[model samples]
Each structure stands twice: as structure tokens, then as C-alpha cells.
Target chain A: MQSKISISNLDFYYGKTQALFDISMEIPERQVVAFIGPSGCGKSTFLRTLNRMNDTIPIARAEGVVKIDGENIYAPGTDVVALRRKVGMVFQKSNPFPKSIFENVAYGIRINGLHKNKADLQERVEKALRDAALLNEVKDRLNSSAFGLSGGQQQRLCIARALAVQPEVILMDEPASALDPIATQKIEELVVELKKQYSIVIVTHNMQQASRVSDKTAFFMLGKLIEFNPTQKMFTNPDERLTEDYITGRFG
Target chain B: MENRLLDQQLDLLRDKILLLGGTTEAALHRAMQSLTERDSELAKKVMDEDRIIDQMELEIDRLSVEILALQKPAAHDLRFVISVAKITPILERIADHAGSIAEAAIKINQEPQLKNYIDMPLMAEIAAEMLRTALDAFTSEDAAVSREVILRDQKIDECYHRVFDELIRIMINNPQAATCAAHLMFVAKHLERIGDYVKDICELNVYLREAAFIKHSPNQ
Candidate 1:
């Protein structure tokens, strides 16, 4: 399988306090790769570096090569906006704007000028909603406020908004952590379905969710990548003692 | 972090699986001892105790399912639970084979005695030893011992083939001993199957230790 993103000897820092060690991994194209560890283990920090999402933080800085399709994204003169457009992100909290459902889905398309006309924007919004598995739930109420929907629906809206720009990769940081089990199941199923077209990188504290949604799993600890293997192999028999200890609830 | 409750539950499950293995192993010993010692009453006792083994299997399966559903265990814990769930049925089948051997013993004791047991008793010894070692490997989580038990299964198979040829020779030479020899052959077959079940248990022990199955693998 072709790699969608590759990180080699990557390190991240926030004002001299290192958040990540020499992390190196290759996320295969159109496969779900999960980053799993405890809070502050650098799973999320490593994930944000993929699209340069850490650039906004005042003290955040990164070194080493983060390549997408053999092009170093951290090289000089690289457009951060275009990188983010190609590698969209969803967050732990479902932060849907106080706009209508259609507008929420259409927000990215309009900002990027991705559509040629109003009809084109409408089609793209519907397709994104369908891809997010939320079209039928709110098709009749596209004009309704995004907040009117439940937390899970709002999260899917955020996912649909990410999908609107046709990103080649989607990075989800605990996308369903705030939702209930059934809602979480829907999002997990949607993620599995979306992998057919887009590569997915998920950071999750829920080990079961990572096992359920990801084809490949990376375990992290103390700012280091401890183990990377197929999800089944990682869950069944992780190589490192720390990875086994953490996954078995023995220690973290 | 410690999930004390899950850890305790898993420990309890391990103990229960050991108990099941012990019960089945004892039943096989009693069954074979009855056959070899010409004790029909002891054979009847082995037949009666099969129900308890069945019940133990069901209880183990129930606990395994509960742990899987409630704890969502991963890594070694997951492998252990799944291995127990699989090993339970294999042990139950071994107990059933023991019961069959007991029945054959009862039937053979009613008939006129054939030539004294030779390879059949040896086969029973090997099968019982395999079960004991396989259970030991399970408790110790020793793949090395498991690999030994897997290789030991072939010894029992060789003993079974010898018992078959000797029984056929006895039947052909002495026409009156044909029914007795047939019953002995069935007993040998039951013991052979018990060996197979023990090998299955050994394979599960290997899986629990290594998280890789060696069954039907040419490389192993």
C-alpha cells in the first residue's frame, strides 16, 4: 500500500518542554491508523503535527520531516492552508458553528471557493452529508440550527464539514469521546466506511475504539512511539512491555 | 493504573479452567484404571461423572463471555479469555472420550476375556500424561512445554495403530475372542481420541502463551 503520510525522526516542543520524541511512522493510504495512549502521552500532539495544526500555538514548534506524497510539508514556502485543506481535522468537542445544517456543511466549500455555483455547492454539501452518514437524519431540516441536533449529530456535521473540502486524509482527535455509545458506534462505523476513500488518522484514549476502527495501531508513552503494528496483532500481542501493560490496564 | 476487579475476575477464570482440566484429567485416569484393573463398578462411576464435566464447561464459557463483554480486555487478557473459551470445549470432549472408554470397559468386562492388554494400556498412559503436561503448560503459560505435548501426540497415535493391529491379529487367530477384541479396539480408539483432545488443549496453551496457533501449520 502507498503511504499517505510519513513522519521521520519527528520531534515537537512547547516552550522547551518536549511533547514528542523521535516519532516515526508511515500511515498507509486509505487505511485507518489509530494513535492510542493516555492523556498527555503525545498521541494528539503527534497527530496535530501532520497538518501543522500546532502552528497557531505561540510556543509550539516542530522539527524533522513530515511528508505527504513524498513532498516535505514542513519545508520552506509550503502553504499551511493548502496542507490543512488536504489534511482536514476533527476535534474532541463537536464545535459546530451556530449556522444552519446546510450552511455548516457548506462552510468549508464556500471558504475554499471549491464550488463553481450555488447548485454545485448544494450538491457538494449533500454529498458530504451523505459521506458523513448524516444526510437522511437531517435532510428535511437542512435549514435547522446545527445545535438543534444531538451531540452525535453535531459531531457528524463537523465531520461533514471536514469532508466538504475533499481532503485526502482526515485526522480525528477523539471524535466521539463526548458522545454516548450508540452515537459513538455510528461515528465508528462512519469512520470505517470513510476509509474506503480517505486515509484516517485517529487519536483515541479508548483502546477498544482504536481497535475497532483502525487497521493499524500505534501505541505511545512518555512522548515516544512504543509499538506500531496491525490492530489485531497490537491488541492480541503487543511487542513492548509498556504497550502490553497499558493495553491490559496493568499500568500507563 | 490497575483494574483490580478485572484482574481478580481473570485470575478466578484461570483457576476455574485449571479446575476443569483437573476434573477431566481425573476422569480419564479413573476410566483407564477401571479398564486395566477389570473394575466395572469404577467404570460406571466414570460414566456418571461426565455430567459434572459438562456443567463445568458451561460455567467456564459463561464466565468467559461475561469477561469479554464487561471488561473489553485487550492484549494478554483478551488472548487468555479467548483461549479458555476454546479450551473448555476441547476438555469437555476429552471427558466424553473418557466416558466412551468407560462404556467400552464395561462391555468388555461382561464378555470373555481376550488377550491381556498391551499397547492399549500404553496408549492410555501416554494420553493421560499428555493431558497432565498440557494442563501444566496452561498454568505456567509455557509454550515450550506445549510444543512438547504437541510432539507427544504422535506417540499416542503410534500406540493406537499398534493396538489396532494386535487386536485384529487376536480376532483372526481366536474366533471366539472376536467380540472382546472388537470392544478392546473401540477402547483403543477412545483413548486415541483422548490424545487428540489433549493435543488440542496443548495448542490452546501455546496460543495463550504466544498468541499464535500452531494447529495445522506445517512450519510448527
Candidate 2:
């Protein structure tokens, strides 16, 4: 199901670093919203807060509400684990387990206790791989080790693993940062394809990559969201001078 | 230069400029060729080709304007399109100077080759080099090299005055070569003007560095 996540007065701190201010925005369902900025502008920090991935950090503290599908996942009795199952994540590095590729995908579903039978599990693994456009590459070698796959292949596997859980939201924290150009292109193609079935939020440092892949782009600076708009306007004619200066290789 | 896409587009535009530049360069070439050989037909070709280059300039301009309006480009994309818009017509102006050289060559073709040949071809060569490098600046986005082109225009002007002085001596020395020498002086002036335009583009890149502000003609 397509789900919209709304952030309201979201404030975050990494051991008093104060990574984000009273940031507020609405990310439309089924559209890729790319969080962009300099290295430490809270783009990735804000993305992590969407799925409550920040809670795992020992000193990371947050305030305000981030609601997905009108439900405040941070509210009392809100299951963090269940919320995570719904909002899967892919990291900058492809962290596939040193197991057969089939087990790598089945691991998420089995751990979630969401499937009833072996056939159902198999269908999910195959479907997610197919959706990621990686099924063809590893179809004949389902039992092959995921670690043996290339950087791009492993990243696509991580995405497929996220999809296998049937999550409505997938948060990618610099998913293509570790890959080469051709691999980056494949991941970008996958992100565009994934937009049809899920709401994806990606944190990227590459300005052109954001322009190429995202539907909407949000620029962050000095711990504040400077501007957020359609990708075309954000990259071409951004309203804020600070945003324009930053994107044009000015004082960043 | 390694990127075929950027290089190919730059080359197409470069070829367009040179094709346009060639007409002017040819005008200067044939003007001198005519002065040296007394070929009136070659002089006429330069004048006719100038009008044709002007028409091609207009067509190229319309096409470039259409791309900017329709494509709705972003930062680097915007930079590229805007630079093309500025670069194409500078090439046309250089062609205009070539046409003037043809006009001068026709007059000189009927008379004897004058001592004014000393600085005229040298000035044309300087102008052609400036046009060539200014285009190289556009193709590479090399602001530093563009500045070099901008600086070279002064040298072209200096050469123009030297030609003006030399031709004045020819006009006084031989009354028959006076009209032809006067025509060559204007051709040198036109070449110098083309150099000024290439420098205008060096600064034009600065204006377009942020956003494209298309200048509207008086009526439209």
C-alpha cells in the first residue's frame, strides 16, 4: 500500500549536537523524496528518524511526531520492531549476511513471522528479487552466497530483502555511495522502479544523483530544512538563495 | 574533450561557428588572395556568403532559443544551453567581418596589391585566433582561456591601428591604391570588431553563471 509520512516539528539531537531543528514536511506516498545537503546537515539523521532507526543509537534523542499513514509510530505502546518491519532500511554499505542468497531474503520474512508456509516464503523471495530487477542475475544460483555478489548486486539484494518484508516505506541511507558508476546507474534504475510499489526516502550527497532519481528534493543546511520542492524546481530554480548557492558549488 | 556527448555538441557548434568563421576567414583569405591575384570572382563569393551566414545565424539562434524554452534545464544543463546561445552568434559576427573583408578584396582586386598587405592579414589572423579560442572556451568552459581570448582583442585593436597607419601611407603614396586601401582599412576594423564580440562572450559567461536572462530586442 502507498503510504504518506508526515513530519511535524521534528527535532533531533546526537548527544547534544542538535542535528535537526523543528523540521516539518509531508512526503507524498509512492513518490521518492530525496534528502540532500552537505555532509552533516541532518539529512541522513532525519531519514533515520522516519523509521525510528535513530532510537537504536545510544545517545540519539528526538522530539515531535513522525506519522506514517496517520499513525504516530513513536507514540506509547507503538511497537518499534513492528514499525521497522513496515519501514525497512538499506544502508550506505551493502550489508548482506554471509549466507546463501535465498536465506538472505528469507531471513527477514521468517524473523517477522509473517509467512505461513514454505511456498509463501519462496514466492515472496522470488517476487522481491524480480521487483528489484536482480532475479535474472541470481535466479540460477538462489543457493549461492550473497557475499560473493558484486557491490551493486549485493545492494540490490539488500533492497530485495527490504521488499521481501512487504514494507510500505523503505529508507535508503546513501544506497549508491559505495558502488561504481554502472552499479550506481542500476541502483538508480531500481529506485525509479521501486517508486511504483513503495514510498522511498533516500539520503544522498550527490546533487546530480538526486536530480536524476527523485520526484521531490529537500535541501538541508545548518540543521534546518532550507527548501523542499519538486525535483525539477529544486535543482533548476530553487526559491531560496542559500539553496541556490549551495547547489551551484558556492559556499556550502 | 573525452566525453563524446559534450565534445560532439561542442564540435557541431564549433563546426557551425567555423563554417560561419570559415566564411569570414575565407573572405579575409580571398581578399588577400584577390589583392595578390586580382580575382574579382573570389571577392564576390565572400560578400554573398556573408548574407547566407547571417541567415544560418538566425536559424541557429531560433533553434537554440527553442531548446532553452522547451527543455527547462537545470544548473549544468542550463549553463550549457545558455553558453551555446551566447557562442553561436559571436561566430556569426566573425563571419560578418569576413564578408567585409570580401568587400574590401573586391575593390583591391581591380587595383594593384598595396603595401597595406603588411598588417591586414596579420590582423585577420589575430581575429580568427580569438574567435577560435573563444569557442574553445565555450566548449571547455575554461574561463581562464576565455580571459586570454578577451586580452587578445586589445592586440587585435593595436594591429588595426598599425594597419590604419600603414594604409594611410599607401593612400598618399599611390592615389590609385587609395580607394582599395580605404576598403582594406574597414575590413581590418571589422575583424577587430569581431574580436571585441568574442571578449563580450567571456564576460557573458559571468552573467549566465547564475541564470539565463534573455535580452529582448526593441520591438519584441
Candidate 3:
């Protein structure tokens, strides 16, 4: 299994305060790796660093080497736009473009000029929707408003928008945290399906969701990477006691 | 530490399992006492008390399922529930073997004594001791104690072999003592089977403590 992204001696800070300390891990190719911990543990912050999502924070500073496909993403003169195109992100809330379902997915393809013509753009939009497992549900309503769909459908629409760019890696920050059980199940199933084409890194507070959807799990505590192992081993018999305590709901 | 609602439920589950263990251990002891004393009424009492053991197994099964479904325990808590679910049946089977021994005792008491019942009583004592220690290890979650309990099974096996040969020789030599010798042989076999069940319980104990399966492993 080849590693899609590798981080070593990664340290992150918000202004004068350090949030992550000497963090290092590998994200395997085409596999889902989940980051789990309590709130304020820096799992979400660490996830944002993968694609420079934290670059939006004026006071944030990252110092480390983040390599994707053997190229350093943090090197000087690196194209942030190209890096973000290869590493797409879906947020906790579904932020559709207030456009039709078809246009929501076509937005990324149109801006990136990924298609040859109008017909090619339509084909790419349909393919992205199909890959996100939302085509069958909203095929007839492709021209309808994105806000008209259910919460789960909108989240999948965001996923389709990310998929439209054909990223090699996808980062999701609590993707299904706001949804109900049935809707959460749909997202989880979609995640398992999406791993065949793109490596996924998801930061979730839901322990069972991580166990259900991820191939590997990384436990974070107070900005430190406590343990990283196969999901089955982590859930059944984790190597660290802190991981066990957190997963079993015994942590303070 | 903050007290969680799950901790109370887990405590109740632990109490139920310990109660079941105590009841099964007592059943094994009383069944052996009836056999050695030639007390037919005590043997009947032991046989009748098996229903309680059956009901306890059902209760444990229901509680385990509830915990798994509602609470959704993970890691050590999950392993503990699984161990209890597996161990309930083994304990019930041990009690069932004790009932079988009680039935044999009733049949053998109808005739003259066979060879003073020496080795059979010793085997029963060892099996009962192993059951007690296995239950203790389970309650304490001690893997080392579980390993020691597993090693004690060999003593019961050796005693069973000796009782088997002695009973066979007595049956061949004294034709009138054939029925009594046969019943005593079955009692010995029942004790041996109980030993194996105790070993299984100890294996589960080790799993509950260490989160590792030692059963059928060459190193264990």
C-alpha cells in the first residue's frame, strides 16, 4: 500500500499558542483514515493543515513537511491553487452555491476548465453526481434549487462538487455530524464507496462512524497524535489506554 | 472522574454474573457430596436445582444483548460483554454435567458400594476448585490467575484415567458389581467433562483480561 500523503515533525500554531506538537502520520492511497478525539484536540486543525485550509486563519502558522505523491506541499513557490485542486474538502455544513443541483456540481468543473465543451461539462457533472451516490435520487430534479433537497442530499451534493474536480485526496471535517441516523448511514455508505477512487481523511467526533467507515484510525489528544492503527484493532483493542478510555466513553 | 450512566449498568451485569458463578459452584459441590455419601435424596435435590441454573443463563444472555444493543460498549467494555455472553453457556453446561453426575449417583446408591469411591471424589474436588478459581479470576480480570486455572485441568484428567481403569477392572472381576461400577465410571467421566468446561471458562477469563485469545493456541 503506497502512502498518498506523509507528514513528519508537523507542528501547528495559532498566533503565540501551539495547537499541534511534533505530529506525524501517513495517509494510505485510496483508503479512508479517520481522526478522532474530543473537541479542541486539534484533529480538525490537523485536517485543515493537509490542504492549507487553515491558511484562511490570519494568525495560524504551520511548520512541517507535508508530502503528497512524493512532492512537498509546503515547499516555497508551491501553487496553493493546484494543491487545493488535487486535495478537495467538504465542510461540516453543506454550503451549496444557492444554484440548481446540476450547476452546484458543474461550478467546480467550469472554473477549473476540466471539460472540453458544454456537452463534456454536462457529462462530468453527471459522473460526479453518480460517483457521490446522489444521481439516482436527484436525477429528475437536477435543475431544482440545491436548498430544496434534504440535509443528507445536500451533503452528498457537496461531496459531488468536490468529486467534480477529480481530487486524489478528499478531506471531510465532521461531514455527517449534523445529520440524522438514516442520513448519517447514507454518508457513511458513500464514504466507503468513494475510497475506491480517492484517499479520504475525515475528522469526526463519532467513534462508531470512524469504526464503520475508516480503514485506519488516528487518536488525537491535546494536539498530540496518541495512536494510529487499523480500525478493527483500534476499536477492539487499541494500543493506548487513552484511546481506549476515549472510545469507551470513560474519559473526562 | 465523571460517573457515567453506563457504569451503573455494567455494575449490575457484574453482580449477576457473580451470582450465577456462586450458584453453579454450589451445585457442583452438592452433586459431588451426594455421590460420595450415597444420599439419594440429596442427589434428587441437586438434580431439581438445575432449573435455577438454566434460568440464570437466560438472564445473563438477555442482559448481554441489552448492553450490546443499547449501550454499544467498545474496547474493554465490549470485550467484557462478549466474555460474559460466552461464559454463560459454559457455566450452564457445567451445571448440567453436575446434574448428570447427580443422576448417576441416584442409580449407583441403589446397590452396594464400589471401591469406596476414592479417586472419583478426588476428581470432583479438583474440578470444583478449578471452577471456583476460574470464577475468581473472571471477577478480578486476572490473566495470570486464569492461566494457572487452565493448568489445573491436567490433574482432573489424570484422576479420570485412573478411575476409569480401576472401575473397568472391578467390573470385570466382580460380575455382581457391574452396574455400580458402570455408574461410578460415568460419574468420573462427568467430572472430567466439567474440567474441560472450567478450562474454557478460564480461557474466556484470559480474553476478558488481556484481550487475547489463548484458546487452541499452541503457546497457551
Candidate 4:
């Protein structure tokens, strides 16, 4: 199977300080990947590099090729806006627009000019909502303001909004941190369903949630990727004592 | 941290298990002493304390459940909690066997003693040593020391067979000892069972450390 994201000897620096240390990993296509570690270990920094989201802030420099489908995303003359269209992100906060629900989802497709007719936009919006599993709950009230939905429903709206672009890779940065347990489970389920069509990388503080939702698990510490292996092996018999200690509640 | 609370509860349970171990070891010695001196009063005291041992077993079980529920333990904690749970049954069986020894002492008090009990005293001494060493392994969390207990049980087993041979000889040499000899035979059997209890503790100790259940008998 082709790797959806292949990062090799990837290094990142902010001014004089480096944040990532010689990190190399492959996220296979259509599989859910989870990055777990103590805070400020650069999993989220690496996630931003996938879509060139870090380029917006000056002095955040990246070296080494971050390939998507065997194409180097960092190569000169690469259209970052087009690359970002294929790689969408959901943040820790839901951040649903103050607009109505239908418009919130419809905004992405309309701005991208992916559809010409109003009917086409409506069909695409409904399909994205359906794919997010938010269609049934929001089907009767698609015009209601998105802020009126509960935190979980609103997050699902954010996910739907990201999916509306029909991106091939979904970047979730602690997507369920602000949600309750039931809503976290819903997001976990959505990630599982979404992995059938999109390659996903989720950075989470939750160890058991990473064990539950991802096909592969990565452990990072002090700006280094300690281990990347199947989730079961990562949880049960991790190679590094530090990784095992962290998962077993012996340390952070 | 709540993990500190979990560790404290486990330590408390360990203390109680050792306390029960000390109690049973003392009771076994007293039961043997009663048999030696033909003291019916001391035998009754050993027998009555079996109820206290039974109550201790239930209390250990209750605390074990609380640790399992509240700690949501994994790995070694899970293994330690499970070992404690399994170790109770062995401890209870040891207490019951000691109680049976006391009953024998009581019964012999009502009748003439058998051939002066040359091997029964030796067997009880060896059996109590095995129990004491097994509890030592549990308290120190030493697998090597526990393995030593395994080796010593072999000596206890040898003593069991020797005691059996001597009892059979006594029964044949003097038919007048037939009733008293039967009780002595059970006493020998109970001492053999105490050896098995030590073996049980060794197995639980290995599991507590490794989360791996190692069977002593390969054929089984």
C-alpha cells in the first residue's frame, strides 16, 4: 500500500532552538495515526507541516521533505493553497462560524469554486454532513445557527466543515479535548469511519484514547520520536522503558 | 496521587496476610505441643482460633475487591491483587488443616496416646518452617527465597512419606493403637497439605512479580 504521508529525517527549528529531532515516519494511506507524548514534544508541530499551516508564522523553519502520495510538499513552486485544500485540519476548539449550519459547511465549497450551481452546493453540503454522521441530528435544522448546538455536535460540525473540502488527509489537533466523554467517543467513532476514505493523524494527550482510535501509535519525548509501532505493542510491550513507564501510570 | 492510595491499600492487605500467616504458624506449633504434652486445653484454644482465621480470610477478600475496583489496576498491580486473592484460599486451607490437627490433639486427650508420637512432632516442625519461609517470600517480594521454599517442600514431602511408613508400622505392632493411630495418620496427612500450601504461595509470588502464571507441575 502507498504511504499517504512519508516524513524522513524531518527537522524543525524556531529561531535558535530546534523543536523536532531527526524524525522519520510513514503514515499509510487510509489508516488512523495517533501521536502521543508529554506536552511540547513537537507532534502538533509536525502535524502543521503536513499542510504548510506553519508557514503562516515567520521564523518557524522546516527542513527535509514531507511527501504526500510520493510528492514532496515542501518542494519549490508547490502551490501551498492547493496542497492545503487536499489536507484539512480540525482544531481543539470547535470554532464553528457564527453563520447558520448550512452556510458553515457550504462556505468551504463555495469559496473553493468546487461547484457552480446552488443545487450542487446543497447536495455537497448534505453529503459532507452525512459523512460526518451529523446528518440525522442536524437534518431537520440545517439552517439553525451552529453555536446553538452542544459542544459535541458543534465539533462534529467542525469536522463536517473540514470534510466538505473533500480533503484526502485530516489533521486533528486534540480534537476531542474540550468535549465530554460521550462526545469524545463520538469523535473517536467518526475518525474510525473517516479512515475508510481519508488518511488521518490525530495528536492527543489521551493515551487510552490513542490506544482505542488509532491503528498505529507514536511516542515522543523531549522533541524526539521514541517509538512508532502497532498500537497493541505500543501499549503492552513498548520497547523504551520511558514509554512503558508513561503508559502504565508510573510517569508522565 | 490515587496510585499512592492504591499502593497503601495493597501494603495493608500484605500486612494482614502476614499477620494471618503468623497466627496460623503459631497455632500449628501449639497444636503439636498439645499432642506432645497431652494437653486438651491448649488443643481447644487452637481449634477455636480457626474462626478468627476464617474472618481474616473474608477481610482480605473484601480489601482485595476494593483495590481492584477503585484503583483500576493494571500489570503488576493487577497481578498483585490477583495473587492476594488466590493466596487467601491456600491460607484458609492451611488454617483448616491446623484446626484439624488441634481436633486430633483433642480426640487423643480422651483416650490412650499412640506409641509416643516420635515422627508426628518432627513432621509438624518441618511443615511450620515451610509456612514461615513462604510468608517470608511474600513479605520480602523475593522470588529466589520463594523458590527456596519450593525446594524445602520436597524435604517436607520426604518427611511425610517417612511419617506414613512409621505410622503403619506402629498400627501393625500394636493393635491397641488402632483408634489413636488413625488420628495420627490424619495428622501426618495435614502436615503434607501444609507443604502444598507453601508451594501455592511460591506460585502466587512468581505471578505477582511477572504477571506470568508458572505451573509447578508440567504434566498438568
Candidate closer to the true structure by lDDT (higher is better), 2 or 4: 4
Model 3 misses residue A31 by how many Å? 1.6
What is candidate 3's lDDT per residue for B1-220, written digit by digit as tens? 5337778878888898899899999988999889888888998998999999999999999989999998889888899999999998999999999899999999999998876785988898899999999999999898999999999999999999999998888989998998999888888999999999999999999998888999999899
For B82-117, candidate 1 gives per-residue lDDT tens digits of 999999999999999999989999988888766568
Write one digit per residue (lDDT tens) for candidate 4, span A1-252. Answer: 678999999899887789998999999999999999888888899889899899988998998889998999999999998898899999999999999999999999998998879999999999999999899999999999999999999999999999999899999999999999999999999999999999999999987789899999998887799999888667655667777666656764
Q: Enumerate the candidates' DockQ scores in order.
A: 0.81, 0.11, 0.63, 0.13
Q: lDDT, candidate 1, residue A236?
A: 93
Q: How do these models rank on TM-score, best leading?
A: 1, 3, 4, 2
Ranked by lDDT from best down, the candidates are 3, 1, 4, 2
TM values, all candidates: 0.97, 0.62, 0.97, 0.73
What local lDDT score does residue B90 receive in model 2, on the 0 to 100 scale? 73
In terms of docking quality, model 3 is medium
Candidate with more favorable, higher lDDT: 1 or 2: 1
The digit string of per-residue lDDT tens for model 2 on B1-220 reads: 1233433453555456556545545555665565556677876776777778787687667756665565444555556666667766776766666666667677766776665477766776777677666655665666667656776888988988888888898889888778878877787777778777867776555434544332332321
The C-alpha stretches of model 4 lying farther than 4 A from their native spots are: A1-8, A24-34, A49-52, A64-88, A99-133, A160-171, A188-201, A207-217, A226-252, B1-14, B24-40, B54-93, B100-130, B147-197, B215-220
Comparing only chain B with the true structure, the TM-scores of all models are 0.97, 0.76, 0.97, 0.93
Residue lDDT tens for model 3, A28-123? 999999999999999999999999988899999999989999999889998999999999999999999889999999998988999999999989
Instruction: Give every prediction's interface RMSD.
Output: 1.3, 7.1, 1.7, 3.7
Give Cα-based local distance difference scores for all models.
0.93, 0.79, 0.93, 0.86
Candidate 2, residue B182: how far the Cα is off, in Å? 30
Per-residue lDDT of B114-209 in model 4, one digit per residue for the tens? 666866777788788878888888877787777777778888778888878887887899888877888888988998988888788887886665
Clashing pairs in 4: none
* Per-residue lDDT of B170 in model 3: 90
